[model samples]
Target: MTTAKTFSATSVQASNAATPYFSQPIIITSLEQNIWQQLEQEIVRSLQRLHCSRLQDSTLLLLHKIITNLVKTMHRHAFQRAIEDDLNLDISDKDSIFTELLQNELSMHGDRNIRKFCRANNFQITLIFPEEKDTLIQIEYPTSCNNSAYLDNKLAKAIGFILVKQTHDPSSSYSRAKVVKNTAIQSFRPEQAGYSQLLTQTEELDKAQAIFSQLNHGIVVFSSVGDILAISPAILTLLKLETALPSVHTFTNIIPDHFYNDVLWGLALESQEGLFENYRTRIRLPHNNNLSILFNISGYRHSDTTIHTIWQVVSLDHKATDTLAEGSILNEARVHNITRNYIPQLVEEKAREVVRLGGHTLPNEECQLAILFCDIAGFTTYVENNEQEESVIHTLNLILGKITKAVKKHGGIIDKFMGDCVMALFKEPHKSVLAALEIHKHSYDFNSLRMRASRDLLLLRIGIHWGKVIIGNVGAAGRMDWTTIGDVVNTASRLEKNCYPGAILVSEELYAMVTHAHATDISFSQPFYLKLKGKRNEQMARYVQTEDEPFLHDTVAHSARQHLKTD
Candidate 1:
């Protein structure tokens, strides 16, 4: 398994190319960093957007709730970026808002203006937006946080709370642009005078120079208008630029003109939250074949109106060449890139294949979602009694692998794994039911294989429910976990516990959703009302039986099954 490569903060020496890449992980602010001072000054001057939304109080309330929920979820390993309308925001701008709202926790009940709402005994708010330079004065709602990456459930929930109607139609949700791989770039057009002034500022220049020296990867900074500000020595080495860079390091001068559109696409940040693929291209070399580079582009506000677009460049993965052959090797900049399907819960290798064939990451959404929860029956007892530690682990992994396959086969995205349990999400209700049916049917065969091996046969319990769930990045500053969570998730988990061994139990809500779908070949038991754990009221549930297994059309077996379709 490839691990994240770690670079020294202030070193020129490159680590072994075979070693994994590890960028600095960002963390949420705690009390120690004097969090208040930083937060008090971090709110951007774009308070007008919230007030102008026509639902000022509700919007502020909604923003506060999201910021609160996200902060509470942030641990040491998760990172998040905040975006508004497709532009990335400095999600780290939590300090200013936190300082103001920490004590004023408001009651979000009625329709009232923000000023009045802020005056409420316990009202507080926070907002997340993409990084951009605007001269909007410092008039912000009291609550906000810097954010990025997955936590779809939170985002969807937040959006649902504020927008009575969606901004985009369902069909327009998926991106139409050629989704590039291993590359992410954001575009910006800063005012010319401000841009030139920023380039000349001693303080800005010093900050840029200081940051460039410590980075171990190639980075090329430019503007949407094609003006290049600075180029790192690492990138200089990759391009084999002799001597020093000329006075005008424009995009046309540095990047091949043909690839400029790719850079523009990278900057054209999609409004949806997703792990985009990096753009791939080759560069001319003085004495060697063109070397390919993986690029991820993003922009940050250099000043009030100047946007500094940063192009992060890394060499494509290759066999570990031992020696740096002058122009042939890009020493420190060598990196092993992973597919943008960064969510491990999702069967990414296949997802990447889907992406290659025009299927992209599901946009940040609050859509009707079907959530499936599956777990091994009696997993705890089995773990303790199993004598061979390695054997047990291996067997468990094999079982989980099979489950993962079954879920993917029937078009389900594995959300996450918890011990012996797995969570999968689907956009289609019928597909979700089909996936569950296939898994339950496949379980019998799977257990039989284990029995032949003289190992314990696994009994699976699965629960599925349908409801609206948010899908996006939910983590800290540098870490992200792409998954879904909401009442539907909780209901599914509850129903899973009520499941009998070797059976797929489903919630009443789920059963209702799929009942009308004549497309499935399954049987459902009558609603079984039971008092679920930690619940004040009893809920209705049912068991799903696979009367006949449906063939996964997307699978290779679909072609061979043409003859068997009549059965």
Candidate 2:
């Protein structure tokens, strides 16, 4: 039950006193003073990023005084970074800059920029002290107020100012202070050097960002350390987040604990091999609906040993499609080319079935089949330590070629290639087991050759199970994949994930079929119970492997006979 650790703003509590009054000033330690200074700098940076006009000298002084007073009070429990709703401030002076800013109601030119800034940003300031832990002293430029008469009352509470209203009286003696225009503000017509170029660049950047954000149907970018760089609006919406952005800064906070390991594994593969694509699975959301998503990762490496990963998450239920409208030549050509290019790569059985349907959609059908999954163990580590990219890729392809040939030789259909793993389907459970044994033998020979060559040994872990599954095309209109879907697929994958290197794990159902047939050449370990992920009950499975030279020839001949029967 491992979980992600959450990061929070640093805060310190007074160790000596349980309660201290504002009137009784406490000596501020250097460390506490440093914390306040850092918080002040953070506030300044936030405001600057928002393009707010610089605070006037009087306002700056007031802000410093407030922070200084808060630190001396020894009543501060925590300092929180600003969130969307409010910005807290403490005010004691009636003639302060905030009062002047709020008092401008009748004059058209009075504090208009400041008012726009506050309203646009939804800025509010709050302060909490020892006596009033629940009560907050707030200063905000209100957008609307219900009671005008209560606004005139200057009643002070335990801490300080609560809320100030805009005064419209013409005869009032409160003089409006001079507004400080933002220095960076400029007219549409540029007048300074590089101003036009800068504005053009800024506009282009803004448009690019807007396009990128909209394109993020479920895309996310994060650093190697799991710090989230960006997440798409679609993902935020899918997650049903209350805020416009994610509250947590790390990717692990948003990912389910059960799926974290899979994500980490993908990241490892991508980091070492540069890409991990088309990994499909169904994730149960908090709303209890299972959403089918295809995860793809692309890694960018920098010279300083930093890797940033971009994850493209496509929803299988609502996959993006390009629709052909009347008189749209580009759309028609694009769709035609994509379909022509993709159809040939599909499994032969599925491709022929699709063609036989004569442009009609194939309905999903359930049938019993044996699912097999296999992957190279220690592949990511070997790739990371080995700098020769070409050699790594060549070795990977060689191993996959061997596995693919074994699967085809045992009457199996290659379903898909998931980075280091390959999935296949077979009509017979015994054939699937035979395929797994063949793959183990191929890996053993490959490892022996690599060992003699002084190269890293790559071992394979395989899993097989026989169960009923639905086979059909899944995706949006104009874009779909012929694939198998059911619990059997997941269970087979889990078996592969849980198995040790150079071993083949099979579920009781599949193992029973093999043993009942009395396959004398095959050898299996003792039956074991596995508590697989996403399963309510433990599963019974056994490791199936091949024996030494005495049984090898007979097993290969048996596999050949099965393959010929299927042919």
Against the true structure, whose lDDT is highest? 2
- lDDT of candidate 1 over 75-136, digit per residue (tens): 21122221221245344424565323322422231112222322232222222232233211
Error of 2 at 496 (Å): 0.4
The whole-model C-alpha lDDT of candidate 2 against the native structure comes to 0.53
Q: In terms of TM-score, which candidate is strongest? A: 1
Q: All candidates' TM-scores?
A: 0.40, 0.37
Pairs in clash, predicted candidate 2: 87-124, 87-125, 88-125, 88-126, 89-125, 89-126
Instruction: Tally clashing residue pairs in candidate 1.
Output: 66
